[model samples]
Target: MKKITCPLRWILFLFCFPVVGSYVCAQDSVSVLFIGNSYTYVNDLPGTFGALAANLGKELTIDSKTNGGYTFQNHTTDPLTYSKIHSKPWDVVVIQGQSQEPSFPDVQVNTQTLPYAMQLSDSIWANNPCSNVMYYMTWGRQNGDSQWSEINTFEKMNTRLYHAYMRMADSSDRAMVSPVGRVWSYVRANYPLINLYNADESHPSLEGTYLAACTFYTSLFRESPSGSDYHPGIGAGEAWVLQNAAAAVILDSLDHFHLHPVDEPTQASFTLVQNGDTIQLTNTSSRATTYTWDFGDGQSAITEDAQHTFGGNGIYNVQLIASSSCNTDTFSIQVTTLGVHDHLFDGIKVKTSDEFIELTSSGGTFLIRTFSIDGKLLTEQSLSNKNPLMISRINQFQVLHLTDSGGFEKVIRIF
Candidate 1:
């Protein structure tokens, strides 16, 4: 089978995209500090998240400065919270507010919640300028909050929570949201059988905490959690579904969240077109002066656009390094070329590049679904030969399952 590699897209604004910030791309040992209240403490959300990270082969040093009913305002005045912020050069700090306060009226939140959020975010950046501050976008009550007349349903409450958290995340130049709440909305819609609420209908149950952990894992790593083997108390199948929901929401549309605001480094990207044994390269890098290409077969080039014929038909990792005086960025993809018989699959042509997966059917309308190597659903759509479907936010490995209109099914692995 042939492979279409879609490299991760690094955007400057989100808290963590595929290749943004030094902390996000670190090889291992990501320190995360969660500062919240019962929502965080319930079911040990931080610990759950840490375990998920470790299961995925990333060591996440976890700590929390939490107290019951503590809001962002409460943390602002609390000395322990400030101490935690200054204690170490943490890679990421996740701060959450009292669940109800943010969903309140904007007039009240702008004063009581928003400013305090900005103050706390400012403190994180001031302590460690490289520290990535992520807002813990909490979920809504299972039912709506009866105390608020405007938010009388789950949807209303969640909408309020979403807007309120976005308000907090938007106020800072160097802050972004983990978006656990948005992921919760996805679970509620896609997997209603999973109860994310405690008996009180507010705090997270063990399963709910797992869902939140899954969300944070995807946010921090910019990858899917479906590959992990640990699920704690949740069933393996259910855990897989939760992990899928996290990836679908967090990774599929990461740019919708504000992740970073310090000056962006140069952005690097490129595309590949292969025919027979020769591969053509297109340099799409922005704000860069010099370029370097590694063909993975030991042959390399320095031009912005070049072509190379491989020694034989095999798999090779193609890499590009785009650099400027102040900074540099790199992107790589696995390229598989044939020494003869140039063909573009007359049935369907599926390709991935620059954070997107594009599928175009030539012969007929087909049902197409893409998955991670671990079998987590990434994108699903129906496209006739005329209209191609292009999805944003693709992972490193994808498995495409296709079904033609005549009811013929085929599965192809993409490397």
Candidate 2:
């Protein structure tokens, strides 16, 4: 045989490798922990998670701890240890040194601090097992202070911090960096006057905080902020701005790496009462390849056809899921107990003049019956092969009795 090789072989192998790998890494939910100082706690950054959850329709648990001016040195040097984080489980831990430490004149302080932060992260993972660590790369103060002259200006100071954080995070396979600083850097380029801090240019104002909140929401929740009357995009003036640069960094970093898991299957359907107590679900979508049924009354099925007999007077949520190779649709049918003469029947016009009652099946089968006050069935007729029955003269305080060909008795009381 000739020594010929196929070019398509390598491509097929590469494509199949990831698809097989994703199945092994799919997760139901993600848990995150935020560890920072006043920058994270000042206006309760973690508190905004609820709003993010409501907006994105995602359920995630976030725990955060903050100190006013604590640095990595303070964290590793006793007094304030990782005691609170020792016992619980976490999927990801976000850590940041004191906001100013990265740009400090003494490189020794930052050099010493990075190792301690990494050590603490390792200890956290050792205790919890399956956890990843991430660093929050913060920005410099807007004011160009004399102590940071080596950084030239506030912008340069923040830039150095961003690069340094990334280098530290990239060194270890277990750690990653949230580019909150890069987001700020991009924003500062467009709006030179837009400082996230207050008049001191060191702390954030309400507008600054809102902007920061948007970045965090987008980064963690994967939802973009819709410019409302209150919050406009970055194009609007500072007063109308809602999201800050730090948040944008985090959001962009997340987007750069597609981190969303594969969607789970869902099913939806409508339920119909074929007879008084027998309920049947009809698949609305034509594409449903498989059906899963969970009838609220302890009935379940994995077949396309699902049938249930409701025994008593109560409300039940009948859930049906229809799924295909591509997607799944879920629907819930609420079967409620109804008094014979429920108001829903008020809109139905009666076609008879005597004390007549009509029984209807969801499959369009209908029967009419006339009854005496003592439950005596005077006359009965098949009104329609399949439809709701039309009865007249059904006044207040009367009982409806229906007798099927199978000798099934359905009793409905008119109030």
Candidate number of the best lDDT:
1
Per-residue CA lDDT of model 1 for 151-220, tens digit only, reads: 6678898988887887676566525688888999989998898888877777788889999999998888
lDDT by candidate, in order shown: 0.74, 0.54
**Worst window of 10 by summed lDDT in candidate 1:** 2-11
Residue 297, candidate 1: Cα error in Å is: 36
| Top TM-score hit | 1
Error of 2 at 261 (Å): 6.9
Report how far off residue 324 is in candidate 1 (Å): 13
Residue-level lDDT tens digits of model 2 in 1-415 = 1111212533343344321000111233666677776666544555554343444455556666665555666666643347646636766667778766666544564466667776767766666644656677776667544454556577777777865676556443325565556666676776667666665565555555556656655555455654423432234556344444444445544523222222321224442433345555555432347788887888799877676777776788778877766467677766655344333222222222123344545332224455665767755666334455655543322445554444444544332
